[model samples]
Target: MRGPSAWSVADRELMAAFVSKVNGSAFCIGAHSATAERAYQDGAKVRAVLTDLDSAPVAEGLRATLRMLGTLTGAGTVSADDMREVLSAGVTRDQIGDALAVCAAFDTTNRLADAFGFESPGPGGFEAGADHLLKRGYR
Candidate 1:
């Protein structure tokens, strides 16, 4: 499903990392950010997205999706204009749906992980885990 989306794998993973950060789930932030970094083959893109989404080196479509996801992390509902932003960026309805699915799933996972006191491995562990996931997949 994610493979066919307009947003690349790195973009989706970066969104997950961003959502984790917004939710303050340290475990998820470490894990997802490492995954995004590994998918991007480095940390620069991930850093850009996490540090300043507006200035991230991604396309307008991805930037809009990221912005929508950021708003999604809040307690309020997503407005039609948010969807418009994504659409105006050339993201298809299907693509937006995929992106929102990723964000929503991560939102639940981050909360669960935090509520359960899931401890993150250190930086080394994050990279190692990401490598394992890339090689073996989440299944």
Candidate 2:
């Protein structure tokens, strides 16, 4: 959400997908993965991240930031040293905040989805929307 306005839309979706996957929200992960694929002309990147965060081919800075978010979500605390590591990797304060926001948002959403037993979309459900957007030159 921070960073240059020209930051890749696909990357944002990838971030969302990554957060969803980390939170174990199948629906969001699938939906955002499809969204990112539609925006990037390749869904594999999203799939890869969903399957394995550390292996996802994102910028190193983003990887470090996401890793921090993961630790925060899992441990409920982000130390000053963690902040320094991400900053040293070139992540801006705004970017770090946005990453935290995304993580927090997804955590809430995941709990809601789980509590309500929200059903996941069927396979390929995201493709239709993604394909339509692609045709409209969203990518």
Candidate 3:
């Protein structure tokens, strides 16, 4: 999540949550989604993005980045046209790289969770974890 990219912390975290959801990691989805909600100030908004990307209430640039991230998560490759779309939508190369970094990191986290069979927390655990993360910082 460390980046000087134009994407906001909320947007980046939402992208991470989306990637986690795509990877079928409930724990990650919860953790990142709660953080995103804290930053964005709307849990429903994050959930909307999680459930559907096309109509999510986010900037076009962020939507484009999320699309590229989705492509990376699902297909393991980003097409030239996909890159073009994101770039054309005003997402900088740095932002794209940052998004890819989040995607890559979460992909590994998801696998590790599955490999070790990490148990997902209860309904309220995500919010608590988000609070802790915000207080302590990701570093």
Candidate 4:
């Protein structure tokens, strides 16, 4: 999740969590959601997005991007019209590219996590993992 990009670390983690939520991977969702909540220093935004995007209290660009990412994860591909929708919502080409990269990586990671039967470590472990990732990242 650590990279030079327009999205902050918290945003990227949220994207990962959203992707996992779409893929129905609870382990990935809980882990990344906790990381995102910790990085953002609040859970409200994360909870809102996880609950519903239409009124998620995030920027237009982010909502559009996340919607597109969610569609891609569910549909396995996004149409050019989807790209246009995101662009029309004010997400730049560079920003969409960055978000797409995160989506692609997490799509694979989330699938792998399911395939490997990864289990949730509960709240405390998720918090510790989040803290470690916030401090050191995924390297």
Per-residue error (Å), model 2, residue 66: 1.2
lDDT score for candidate 2 against the true structure? 0.73
Superposed model 1: Cα runs more than 4 Å off? 1-3
Q: Candidate 1's residue-wise lDDT over 46-101, tens digit each?
A: 88888899888888988898888889887546899888988999999988889888
Clashes of 3: 0
lDDT by residue (tens digit), candidate 4, 14-87: 99999999999998999999999999998999999999999998889899999999999999899999999999
Question: Tens digit of lDDT per residue, candidate 2, span 1-139?
Answer: 3245334667666776777777788777766678788888776766776677778877778788878877887777889999999999998887777777767877787778778987766756678755664456333
TM-score of each: 0.93, 0.79, 0.94, 0.97
lDDT of each: 0.86, 0.73, 0.86, 0.93
**Displacement of the residue 118 alpha carbon in candidate 3, Å:** 1.6
Write down the RMSD of all candidates, one decimal each: 1.4, 3.7, 1.2, 0.8
- For candidate 3, write residues 1-139 as lDDT tens digits: 7447677788878887999988998888888999999988899899889889999888888889888888889989999999999999998888888888889988998889878987778768888888877667577
Q: Any runs in candidate 4 off by more than 4 Å, and if so which?
A: none
Please identify model 2 stretches exceeding 4 Å from their true place.
Answer: 1-7, 129-139
- Identify the superior model by TM-score, candidate 2 or candidate 4: 4
Clashing pairs in 3: none
Instruction: List the candidate numbers ranked by TM-score, top first.
Output: 4, 3, 1, 2
